[model samples]
Target: MAGDLVLLTGSTGFLGYIILTELLKHGYRVRAAVRSQTKAKRVLAGPSIKALAPTDEQLSFVTVPDMTAPGAYDDAVQGVTYIIHSASPIPSFGDGEPPAQDQLEESLVKQALKGALGMLESAHAKAGGSVRRVVMTSSTVAVVPFEVYMGQGTEPDRVWTSEDRIPVAPGPYGFEFQAYSAGKAAVLNASEEFVRTRGTAFDIVSITPSWIFGRDELVTDAGGMRAGSTNSVLLGVVLGVKNDAPYGGNAVYGPDVAKAHVLSLDPVVKGNQSFVLNSMMDWEDAIAIAKKYYPDAFAAGKLREDGKQPTMALKWDASKAKRQLGLELAPFDTMVKEVVGQYLELLAAEEGSK
Candidate 1:
């Protein structure tokens, strides 16, 4: 299985790139499905990818401009032994006004369903002979109820797990998070149903991870690091940024999520199952973790000692991930140090350049 060709989507994204590297590190050749050659080139040039220096046979790219298009992955899945479908639309976490309700559903909900379903359809129809497993990148939001994720109502007393399924919330979403959660839940449900009903030769493994944070090699400069995806949310705590509303205190390290995806490829691991990968995290604890790990950053005023970030302590049962994938999830402290450490490194580099 070491040299099996694996088709990977979302190689240009934060988690996708890490999954790419993990695949390569474990001796699996990857055929990355990128949106464009430019994005493919960027992944190759990333520090982690560049360090590996994957050979042509070990790493190559296919331009899949429109994943939601019919038969989008038909050609890409050819001759591939495994499919890691991690590509999906993400909501913009900027300061601007949120998109309209119709627009949100279209972009977040409809597009996600189409892309995921399309990939599975292609795999079943075209590569059923070769593809053994399809490891999908899902999210914790897919398992948790929308009201709990949105903080709209009372929090659930029980711990959420991979087996938990939440109905896709009806549209007219008030904000980005609600729509995003609906999209994930929709995809997870659709993906599992497709495999169960169709009975393809291959099985499906859905990896639902919580807030992922770690060193993002794609982020080059200080500014990019500060505004990076979920990593930014963690780093923002150190930079004295506060969330408008508190988010669930569930988190998983990036590499662990990636590793779980790779590990799921093993035939020994039973398929047609979902794995939740996360550990309970306290957002405010990031402040103390940052100060403890890298006191110099705070002393230099590079990281704030008085930053405020609200935390909603929600319990998650990720035991299935550990038991099945044999993954040891990283705690919030490791996540904070990695994010803050990388930001400080980039900040120092920026200062030196100036």
Candidate 2:
């Protein structure tokens, strides 16, 4: 198992880089699929990846410029024992205006579906004899309906689980989040269907995580640390940036989610199953956690206690991940400390530099 080769997509992304490091740490050889050689170089030069110092055999790169293109992964999947397809389009949260409905559908929904299906097709056709499993990176948004996640109508009284499935919401999606949610859900459903119907040699293990947050070692500067990742959504709370609508209080530590993906690769773990990874979190808890751990920051006005991010609790049954993957999901306190602690550390470094 340690020597087996794994094909990993999205090695340059937030969660993907963590997964890449975890795979190397576990002794699995990685063939990281990057969009370009530049991205591969960036990932290799990253602090976390450089720390591992993976050699050519231990880590390699294959450029698949367009994941949605036909036969995109045919060459990359060869001889690999597993495929971790984490590459997906993310919504832009910048100052620019949101894309039109067709653009959103093309970028978020269509691209996601095609990329996922194409990977599976390649593995099945080219590497079916070698590839034993595919651990896909899904999200809690896939399992939770758009209406429920947006807090639009009556909230479901029941706790959501990996077993739950939501019908794909048709576009003209109102915003990026909704379109992104639809994309994840579509990929999950389509992937399952493909495996179930095709009877491919390999099985699928879908990991559905929510609001992943933790130290992003790839981030080098203060500005990058402040707004570079999903951690930013949580960081915004500590910095007193308010969300127009409260984000659901569902989250999982980045490493824990990464662990889920890596652990699922073991043959002993059941195949063709979904795992929900999350911990219920309160938005305001970040302030308390920060103040309790770093009183000087709040005293110096570097961290605020007057943030207005409201918590919308969304219950999820995540016990299966712990029992099945033998993962102890980090509690909200741990998540808050890690995220806020990293921000403060970066801020201090920046201030010291000046």
Candidate 3:
């Protein structure tokens, strides 16, 4: 049923925020698992979702501070019919040194795998018969190998499915790219192992999205750069810190990604499936579209001209998500315009307070 009880992790994150609202708007009773009860309340109290007017019975919060801890999600998983595991740490570059970078990568990959494995084990062992499915948030890095996406090789037009093996990180790739890519790839590898060894009493579906973008209504501070991994890039552009046009990469709307997670729970959704999603627009063209709608904000001195750096075309197939999940992806132009508009408002608010 569409109104089933759902437990959503990472409820205070950029994409998780949207997913939480989408679940509530669609009549699902959500028990959000966040790191802090106070922060979760602050997020749900934000004006963007206050309009949704979810009743007390419709929304709640559970604190799972350390996802890597043993049985961390046991209580959170209790009485939940579905789980949307969207919480994962974003790898950071420290001092840009190889060793520091290597350390960061190793730590992130290990913790990420451990957290995911913990959630899977908990859902299987503790949820009893209440849980039916788990939809995890993965990155397109898992689908498109870094070596090919960086234009060093002609990556096959592979349709990455649950059956596809997670590609290993190339030895020559940049530190951050290799770290993030390998971390996500490890998630797919772990998920496969979970299904193979843990059995399929509760099916697991992974949604791999490329460079998610959209307005973050919950970010009220000037630290937009810290809001999310992808948002940091977009916010960089908004703040003139990133002066490149088209920004370069496939972008997906946050709401649409949220919808994918929700739809993954549908009864028609098959077990142990993986889906790739993106809006299929170039970063440069997307910025140009945003300039069309917000000329003043994108005017000279604010937004820079195209850097003319060539970008690779999206290589992976996302048709399965559209055909099987019945997702009607939002237009890239509209998404860019809306996202920039909200970003400008945030900048204005920041300026007004200063």
After best superposition, candidate 1 residue 256: deviation in angstroms? 0.5
Q: Return whichever of 2 and 3 wins on lDDT.
A: 2
Candidate 1, number of clashes: 0
Question: Per-candidate RMSD vs. true structure?
Answer: 1.5, 1.5, 3.2
Per-residue lDDT of candidate 3, residues 165-206 (tens digit): 556664433556567778888888788778778775788899
Model 3: lowest-lDDT 10 consecutive positions? 91-100
Give the TM-scores of the predictions, in the order they appear. Answer: 0.96, 0.96, 0.88
Which portions of model 2 miss their true places by more than 4 Å? Answer: 95-98
> What is the C-alpha lDDT profile of model 1 across 1-354, one tens digit per residue?
789999999999899999999999999999999888999889999988889999999999999999999999999999999999999988775534567776999989999999999999999999848999999999989988878755676556877778999889998888778899999999999999999899798899999998999989888887877663888777888888866678888899999999999999999999999999888878889999999999987888888866677778788888887887789988888889888888888888889988
True-structure RMSD for candidate 2? 1.5
- Off by more than 4 A, model 1: 95-98, 152-156
lDDT of each: 0.89, 0.89, 0.74
Candidate 1 lDDT for residue 243: 66
- In terms of TM-score, which candidate is stronger, 2 or 3? 2
